[model samples]
Target: MVEGDTFQKFMLDALEIRGEWVRLDDSFAELCQNKNYPESLRKLLAETTAASLLLTGTLKFEGRLSIHARGSGPVSLLMAEATHERAYRSIVNHKAEPFESDDLNHLLGKAQLAITIEPDKGQRYQGIVPLEASNMGDCLVQYFDMSEQLDTFFMFDSDANGCFGLMLQKLPDYRSIQDQDAWDRVTQLANTLSFEEVSGHDNETLTHRLYHEEQVSLFAQEPVRFQCTCSPERSLASLNALGHDEVLDILEHEAKVAIDCQFCGAHYEFDRADVNALFGLGKMH
Candidate 1:
């Protein structure tokens, strides 16, 4: 069992196809460290984390890939984002509840999952897909087919301990559209992955299971990490967006304006002095 925060890509040379796999134990642990989340919520966070990683790996984008879902169920906003630099962050909003077992549809009742790709120098693209897939993997595959018009498969698995994901996509510039036989063969192999096997095994074993029959090459792994880009400076900038009067009013009632990052639960507290300096109300000391 391979254990770490790493991503691997495998390919079948003859088929002109490639697959990406990622295991995110350490990354997910970092996300859950400061937040008090129920087991279900934690698992969802891990699932989204893995999904984001695989999606970013598949799509060659310079800036960021964001997967967000909004639902009327117990959990509301669930999102995970991964950047080209390999940074990751995940968040889930749900009220206090006991540990419970639920499928994706249950946790995300009547929801929509949106995928947004923001490139560094181009216009952003966003795709909205219904929450029809009972699992995150199926939902993402549906997204690719609808949005990109490409046949894509995504397998995402997560538990309280860790998370893992696999993605298979037909090359955009493939030669033959009638070569259903090859696509069927690869997908059939992938379909053999059981929930038990995926949830229980690690990256290496899972890859071996899916592609043992094919001549596949595994690429050098890339490290995945949980990192929050939020900072006091950035938070202060947002406070400025609230305007100077609102900042003073916030300080009037409370000792300080505390802003907590939903992704990492990192708290940024701004006191009156900090506020004054932020608004240029104090001397440059």
Candidate 2:
């Protein structure tokens, strides 16, 4: 496996804090392939993908984590998902107009960001907040502050090569003013990191550079990859969800039912015979 698409977790042993670092290379490129997204939208999707993986790392169950953003501006919808096994995918819907601004709030006006967690054997949970900040990282920080009541810091970057992210969160053990100061110190040090540094440096070097003076324990790195969950069977199930009459109408008009997976651009076609089998009408002679 390539080291570029990797996720690593670490802890500041003495500071009662934990963090995660992720970098995406071939996986990121694969996710963006065949989709001619504008530069800004591409970056936004990449960052969302990275953020999804980071959140997935925090999960204690065997399931998936997803980040969804719906806005009323040029960018209408953006979604990213990552499973416990590290498979990930992302998609973005935007207008044809050129988005020249770098401000996220301007590009995605009045957006709502939602994070959803679906456990394998339990109920799903979701948290949603208004996208008020110019940066997604800051918006996520606000989410943790309000929902989790934990101080969290996030740094994310995307460029021609790949997308990268670093996250730090204070644990509940911080009871004294001294612990709070230590948490502030670590977060401030983390804030000093720039896009160039996060994008250019490896996890080991980045961690060492940021917290060399502190006793940090790094864990084994997990690999992340681009994998779309869409399949012909899944597409057929969706067509079934549209009800038999609607699908029959589509097939009657188009001669066949065609569906495209937005995440991977996979095309699935269901001819008359396939539709007959799907609806238990038997094969057409």
Top-TM-score structure, candidate number: 2
Whole-model lDDT per candidate: 0.80, 0.86
> For every model shown, what is its TM-score relative to the native structure?
0.85, 0.91
With a 3 Å backbone cut-off (N, CA, C), the pairs that clash in candidate 1 are none
Scored against the true structure, residue 121 in model 1 reaches a CA lDDT of: 85
Please give, for residues 64-181, the per-residue lDDT of candidate 1 as tens digits: 9999998877777889999876678888887554435657788878899989999988999999989987778888888888877778877666666677777888887555645557
Total clashing pairs for each candidate: 0, 0
The total of clashing pairs for model 1 equals 0
Candidate 2 pairs with clashing backbones: none
